[model samples]
Target: MFRRTFWFTAGAAAGVWATTKVNRKLKQLTPESLAATAANKAIDAGHRLKDFAVDVRDGMAQREAELGDALGLNDQDAPELPPQRRIAAIENRTYPKYTYNRNEDH
Candidate 1:
């Protein structure tokens, strides 16, 4: 009688453990749970990307300042211009024009 009781208790414990594991897996596979996990990963990636962009911008600015010091350009002489003024300055530069003659053979 004691042996039979022990076997029954062991079986019951195994069944309970198996049921708990299967239920946990099913919960993870549900649509809402899957979407929430994916969204969390995406938000984490976005934060990492933002931090990387800020670091790159800061490094570029530091390099620019170092180059200015090497070239003996002071802040007053080389004031930082807004995007519109920079575009205008680039557009205002003059380059020598070249004429192309297709009929001339070399």
Candidate 2:
């Protein structure tokens, strides 16, 4: 009789726990809840990405400074390349005249 009572109590507790879990899941599955959850996650991811980018920029600047100091480049003026090697965005390029006929009907 005592063993039977113990088993009955345990089963009732399990049922209550399962029902609570299901209800919580159903609530989360609702459209509004899902959207809010997704938006929150997206905002969190955006913040993480922004942080990562800032860290990368900071590290890059630090590395550049270290390299410049090691190479004694900080004290000198930047060198200028010869005119032939320089390219300007406003410069126009000339393309070679071309002709191609790959069609057998040509």
- Per-residue lDDT of model 1, residues 7-33, tens digit only: 999999999999999999999999999
Question: lDDT of candidate 1 vs native?
Answer: 0.92
Residue pairs in candidate 2 whose N, alpha carbon or C atoms collide under 3 angstroms: none
Candidate closest to the true structure, highest TM-score: 2
lDDT of each: 0.92, 0.95
Most lDDT-accurate candidate: 2
Residue 70 lDDT in candidate 1: 87
60-84 per-residue lDDT for model 2 (tens digits): 9999999999999987998987678
- The global Cα lDDT (0 to 1) of model 2 is 0.95
